[model samples]
Target: MRVCLIASGSKGNAVYLQSGESRILVDAGFAARELSRRLELIGVEAQSLDAVFVSHEHGDHCRGLGPLARRYQLPVYMNPETFQALPSLGRVADLHHFDTGSAFTCRDLHVETIPLTHDAARPVAYVVETREGRIGIATDLGIATRLVRERLKGCRVLILEANHDETMLRDGPYPWPLKHRIRGNHGHLSNGDCADLLGDLLWDGLETVFLAHMSETNNRAELALECVQRVLEKQNLCRPQIVVGRQSESSICVSL
Candidate 1:
């Protein structure tokens, strides 16, 4: 399986995962042009994508879906409420609706959805099966859930959220209401939450973990790494090799 994080953050997020003839995009948050350039940089063409699986209706996750789907005539998938919430996406040729916690398939890939704890209408994370190994993509989450733990328990590669530092978020520049929401049960998960979750996984050595959707305004890469590494050390678990995905540049394609 080849995993490439094209962009990740609060502003926008997208990841490209491909195995054999199956090319799947987790989110299409950028414009068609930007997505095209990023894919080309990683040696893929937009038209080659078999399907686009959307996580939520948030603009940062599905902003570019309309244009990209229209351009490539690609099939798009999302839950019913999210699909209805989307601003009249004018360019979509096909739209498939799946329940938030259901399993679905597209071409040569198998996807099992894990419900998310966000304010959006029925968001989900996906556990994808490829020939090489299983990959789990979880982001924009608030607190970790039992469903999420079950889905991600055995993933060979994980792209999960490490969106903020709890203290920083509590004492940062965000207004009072926003801060309360962020630290609530349905807001984003802090770095500490990520560490706690990682401690539960029976991960093999150097298990690839892409810390994605980091809050640029509220978190730092080194700090995020430190938080997660400490927990792994305590549990005598292998410190999963971690890479922070950026919100702008496309990262090197990694294979498992």
Candidate 2:
């Protein structure tokens, strides 16, 4: 199994995954052209994607779903509420709806949808199992629930969200209400929150950790990395290969 963070940030987000003959995209937040360009950067052809699994209806998560799915004639999978929220994607020819907390198969990949806490219509995170190992994707989430931690356990590669730094968020330029929303239980996770969650989820088999969906204004990659590293150090845990996902380029493709 292979995983590549094609792009991740407030601007847009997408993840590419390949297992055996199956190729899938977890999100297509960028425009169709931009998604194609990013996939090309990673040596993947856009037309070769088998399907797209949406995590939510937010523009930064599903903005390109309509055009991208239609252009490639790809099937899109998401919960009914998310599908309803994305009215623009109604024209997609092969839209498939699955309930949250359900497990489904997409070609060679086995996917389990874990419900997420976010200010969106039925947001979800995915735990994908391949022959090599399990890969968990938990982003665009507020608090990491116990279920999220349990579902993500034993993953060989974990793509987790470290959206903001608490101090930077409080001191940043955003207005009071926006800041409150971001710090609220239904908002994105802070670096501290991410670190705390990782402390509980870490296990011997977890080899790679990708810190994703960082805020351009409220978080710096170095700060996010430092926070997680501090937690690991305090626990006297062996550090994994931690990679920070950037908005402009693809992360190194990690294979298991």
Candidate 3:
């Protein structure tokens, strides 16, 4: 399995996954033109995607879903509520709605949907199983529950949320209401929260970790990396390859 974080930040987010003959996109937050450009940079074509799996109804996760799916005639998978809440996604040729917590297959890949705490409609995280091993993608959630830790176990590569640094967020310029929302139960994960989650998720087979969905204003890549690194050091665990997902570009493709 090969995974590339196409883009990840408050502005937009997408991920590309390939295993065997299947090429899947986890989200399509950018405009069609921009998404196509990013895919091209990573040597993938927009029309070549097998399917699109939406995590929620938030614009940063699904803004381009309608156009992308319509253009490519791609199948879109999401929970029922999310599909209902999505803004007028025009004439999606193939819509497959799965219940949250159900497991489904797309070609050779098996996907398990785990419900997440987020403001968007029926938000969920995906744990994808490939021939090599499992790859987990869980961003945009505020807290990591026990179920999240369990589902992420044994994953070879994990794309987990490291949305902000608490101190920065508390002192940042966002209005009080917006700041409160970001730090609330359904908001986003902080660096400290991410580090703690990483400590719980560490295992022998966890080969790579990508810290994703970072806040542009409230967090620095270096700070996020440092927090996770500190946790690894405290636990005396072997350091895994860590990549910071960027807003403007695709992350280097990682293979398992």
Relative to the true structure, candidate 1 reaches a TM of 0.96
lDDT of 2 at 136: 93
What TM-score does structure 2 among the candidates reach? 0.98
* Residue lDDT tens for model 1, 214-243: 998889989999988788778755666688
Give every collision pair in model 1.
none
Candidate lDDT scores, in order, read 0.86, 0.92, 0.92
* Candidates ranked by TM-score: 3, 2, 1
**RMSD, every candidate, angstroms:** 1.4, 0.9, 0.9
Against the true structure, candidate 1 has what lDDT?
A: 0.86
Clashing pairs in 3: none
Q: In order, how many clashes per candidate? A: 0, 0, 0
lDDT of 2 by residue, 1-256 (tens): 8899999999999999999979999989999999999999889999999999999999999989999999999999999999888777759889889999999999988999999889999999999999999999999888899999888898889999999999999999999999999999899999999999899878778889999999999999999999999888876556689999999889999988
Off by over 4 Å in 2: none
Candidate 3 per-residue lDDT, tens place, 142-166, comes to 6798898888888889999999999
User: Which of 1 and 3 is ahead in lDDT?
Assistant: 3
